[model samples]
Structures are given as structure tokens and as C-alpha cells.
Target: MDRTDADGLFPRWIAHRGAGKLAPENTLAAFELGWRLGWRAFECDVKLSADGVPFLLHDATLERTTNGHGAAGARTWDELARLDAGGWHSPAYAGEPLLRLDRLAEWALPRGAWLNLEIKPSPGTEAATGAAMARAVEALWRAHGAGESGGPAWPLLTSFQPAALQAAQAAAPHLPLGLLLDHLWPGCWAVARGLGCVAVVLNHGLWTAALLAEQRAAGWRTLTYTVNDATRAEALLGWGLDGLITDRVDALGPGQPATA
Candidate 1:
């Protein structure tokens, strides 16, 4: 899809951080679980290692998600790669390896999965993280032949950090971008517009019918994050909200989410 397509290039139900707490967040197991649950599109967090290699991870620290200690970005890829990213969630997922960004692309593209790659950088390393991720994905997709001719869906890059988005745009202008918001502050639209973003991913509570229509008129797709309630999901889709990034794949009937 064209990077400028305002009609949007996302599935209606996007798996939040890949099935969201269903498996372990940001691990390959989580993504595979989402795909098995029949979700065509998945969202995930990405950050650069100390050596500049891109990898899947959500927090800036390793304690909550992995069997490691200290700052996540401070660790080299070799160190991060050895960490068991899944055991913290449950014993069933013990020994699941940390997923490299390229490794994920390899797995998902073959399975015909779509992605929302959230550029989650650690403090002060946002610029480098974004640039590296953009470069890595460019190489990844190009090798797989993603375009009008048919291959994988174009991955959408998103982030809550302006520096990361800015660096990504500079590095790979053709990739689709989304600006994630905890709240849509006064300057959020301008920041999104300036970055040439296709969407604004907001906290699910922030959307209103008027706001959705207003953003639609402005040519920006509106997506919500981490929603798990069935009633809210129905309401958002009914409101013409472009996408729902959620954890509750089961909230919709089986085979419902992927088709929605």
C-alpha cells in the first residue's frame, strides 16, 4: 500500500502486543498464539540492544518480562538473546528465546501475518533505536518482496516518542507511521501531521463519535490500544473507528476477529 493512503492499510482487529497477556508479551510464542487464534494483524514493541541490533521487548527493564536484570538497552544482543523472555509469564512457556526483530519478520511474513511495529526505545536512545529499526525492516521486507506484486502486508511503524518517529521517517520515508497517544493533547494532531502519519493510536477511552469523524475528515485513521471489553469493542467498531488493538481475541466469537 502507498504510505500516503488515508483509507488505511490495517485489519479491523489488531492483536495488542501479539495476543497481549495471553502468552508472553513480545515473544515469538505470543505472536504465534495470536496467529493461531486467527488474528491476521498483530502489534508489538521494538527497541535496540546496546550493540544496535533490534529486538522485541516492551519495558525498558527486564524484570517484569524476562529472567534478566538492569536496563534493557544496556544489554548487548548476545546477552539479551540468551535471556528467557517467556518463563516470567508461566512455566508452560519456559525457555522461549528472545525474538529478534528480523526473526519475527521471517516468521510472520511466511504465515501472512500483518504487523504494527511500535518503536519502543529506551530513554535517550530513541533516535538510534528508530533509525536502526527502520533500516532493519527495510532490509527485511525488501528481501521478501513486499509490495503491489504480492507478499506480506506492509508493516506499520508506530511510537509514542517523537524523536523515534522523526528518526524513522528520516531513515525510511516510505514506511507507514502511526503516532501512539496515551491522551490526545493539544499538539498531538500537529505532531502526527508533521510526521506524515497514517494513524493516531490512542488510549481506548479517549475516542468519541465526534472525534472519530473529525479525524476521519482530516485523513487520519484512528486506532485504540489495549482494549479487552466486548461492549467497548462493538461500540468502537460501530462508531466507525478504524481499528481496535486489543488483548481479548476471545471477546469476539471464534473466527470473528480476523474477519472483522
Candidate 2:
């Protein structure tokens, strides 16, 4: 599909890492909460375990989000699945297990929810993680009959690592890709263009009216991340942003008025 066709699949408001700060990030509970609050679009981090299982997690290490220690990628999925992924945030979510990508696809595809699956590879495993995630997502979506006539749109795969995105492109060229940028590094635009990305996701502060215009002129849809402030969201939307990934799901979402 072309840029316009792809743009239709992305929603105006995307819940960041599931329900953002409201629940444990990257957990199934977080996604459920976001869905209940009327968010149809979500962004989550995906990385491959040592055994090549693609799972939901943002950090390279397990210390922050889970009860496990050391590198998360070093453990196989069987070990990772036993960790209390939700306990770090609160007791109410204790014992919430790590989620596999297939499980997420199973829940999301049937609901027709849109997903921005960020390929957050661990250091030194960019290519492997990307390729693995692409293949896994492709299989999961195919099994659910996604991308068929009148079916849900395929998930958009995005990453800050060029090698990861490139590997994903090589593995599944039909999947939509987006380049994530925290800074406008030298040759970043060139890299994104070379990857044939349909969208460019940037830090909320990186956007300006001129930059937005420039990207749009080049036929690339522009989106920003973690925007929780109402005034900033209003400004970005007024500047014609294609999407906004926000943590404030309760206050800023579909049919909800933005408030400070």
C-alpha cells in the first residue's frame, strides 16, 4: 500500500507502551486497560529472547520491569515467562507473566486493534532480533487472516536501529516500517528513506512546523511519542501531525477532550 493507504491504518492517538504509566508497561494488563479506555492504537516494544522467542519488553535487562536479573535476551522464553513482569509496578499486578508476541497478536488481531511493534533489539543482536520478529509477526498475522480483504491492517514495525529495520525489511518487505528518531542524527533521513519507511516517528520535542512540512512534502507521515501534556498535543495536532503516542490515555484519546 502507498503512504495514504497506510496512513489510514494508523490512528490519531496511540497509547504508549500499552496504558503508559497507568499500568505495568509492556504487560497484557496494560494493553487491556488501554483498550477499555477507548484506545484502538498501541505501541509496544518487542525483542527476541536467546531462544529466538519474540516477547514484549523495552529494556535489554530484566532488572527494571521484571523480577529477573541480568540480560533479558540471554534467557530463553521458558525462563522469562516465569518472571513476575507486573510486580515491579504494584502488588495488584503481581505474578503477571511476560507476554509472547504470538499471544499479543492473538488478542489484538481479533479486536481489530492497530499495533506499532517497535523492534527494540538488545545490543549486538539487532539483525537477528529484527528478522526473527518480522517472521514471527508475519506468521501470527497470516494465521489470523490479517491483511486480507476487509481484515485488519498489518502491524507497523519500527525501530531506532537501522540494521534492525533493514533486516526486517529483508525478511518481510510487505510489512510497513517506520523509523524512530530521538535525535536528527547525520544521514538519519537518508537511512529512513533507504529502508522505504512509510512513517517517521520522532521525539515530541523534535518536531517543528517546518520539519513537519518538509517530511510531509517527501511523502512521509510524521508521528511523535510520549506526549502527555494537553497543550503540546494540541499544538502538534494543529501542526498536522499524523499520529501522537501518548501516556495519558485517560485524558487524551479517541472521543476524549485534551486537558492539562
Candidate 3:
């Protein structure tokens, strides 16, 4: 649970969408809620706005999660920012604002919370979006990374799209990257190696004890997704998983440091 090591091993409990189950997901309200609950690390989905700004959002369309409708990528950041991100989740969060990744970084950097920024593209913009996000990350790191002394304690980049991962590597080689997979693909390890990624994030169900063992032996860290049950978490820990991304941050209790 001690994440102070150089291996970029994750915190024991990661709040999905900035404490998704606790508050309006991907909003500042949710992140604040998680931080208040003593959860410092979180996972969030990011996509490029029409103007190329990175915003926190999960769905391809805005209708389900936000007060807007239509493809999220089709809108400019100005347009997206105007929507009420929290109202749909709950009336209590009616005025909650849309969160920008950079703004979140500014907030999280000083707090020692780790962030897993997932590169989510809008349709045909996969490579372009990835590159844009990578460039943004590069700038972010330049402005706030450890070497610069203004960044978060740890910043991790992840993507299911290989092109996006490649873009991140090209844009900022110093930052750690994680390859995401829902199912095992041919040469998955090789692909990860080629991208110079530090970890492989797998769908919880697709991974087996054997797969976990294999990935760990290869010197690649393993993290699973959306696990909310304590028993399941303990089981995965017994399997030697490096991290678990979950919607139930409250269920994790207080996590131990990675060095522990």
C-alpha cells in the first residue's frame, strides 16, 4: 500500500472517477468528497475538447453524464465547460462545474494524491487526441512534475489505444505509462514493452492468477479495474496485484503507504 517506491506501484485504494460512488463522478465535487474521505488517489477519463483542452469525462456522448447532448468531441471546451456536470448525478450537486485535467492537477499536485489519467478519444480522433493529450501532459509535467517541483507526488498515464500510449511516450518519456486491456491480445506484453510502459491494467474479470503471475514475472506491474468488494480486493492482493481501481473508495478503509 506504500506507493513511495520508484516502481510506480499504486495506492491500495483508487477512487474511480474521483470517488465516483461517493459523489458526482468526474466533478470537482466528487474529487473533494474523496479527499475529504481521506482518499488521495483517483482514476478519471479524459478526452479532448474541440479546442484541444483536456476535460474530465467518461462517456463519448454528453447526454448520460452531463446536462448536454451529442458527441462530447464535437463541442468546444467553451461549450463543454458550460454544461452542468454534476446535476445529472444528483440535485445536490446541481451547480458543480466540469473539471479540467490541468485544474485537477493543480489541485492534486499539492495534496500528494496520485492520478491515473485515461486517454479517452472521441471517435476518429484517437491518434490525434492521444497526441494532444500527450502534449498537454508534457506541458503539465514541465510545469509541475517532480523535477519542476510543482506536480503531484505521482502522475500515471494510461490508455487502451496503443496509438495514444505511443503519443504519450513521444510527448513525455519521463512520465510512466500503463497499458490498458479488456482481454489478452496477441503480443500484449511485447506491445507494452515497445511503448516503454511501466504497467498493464487489465479488466478484473479477464485476469487470472496465472495471468497475474505471468505479468508480474515479466517485471510489469499489474492493476485491475472497478473492484468494489473487500473480499475481491483481498483476493487480488493475495494474487500480488499492484493496485485496484474501484468505485468504492470508502470500502478500502485507509490505505497503507506503498512502502509498507
The candidate that wins on lDDT is 2
TM values, all candidates: 0.94, 0.96, 0.92
lDDT of 3 by residue, 3-105 (tens): 4324545775678999867788888888889888777778999999988889988889999888899999999989987998888877898878789989987
Per-residue lDDT tens digits for candidate 2, residues 89-187, read 999999999999998998899987889999999999999988999999889998888768877789889999999999999999999999999999999
Q: Which ten residues in a row have the lowest lDDT in candidate 1?
A: 1-10
Off by over 4 Å in 2: 1-7
Ten-residue region with minimum lDDT total, candidate 3: 251-260
lDDT of candidate 3? 0.81
Candidate 1 Cα lDDT to native: 0.85
Alpha-carbon RMSD, candidate 3:
2.5
Please give, for residues 70-97, the per-residue lDDT of candidate 1 as tens digits.
9999999999989998898899999998
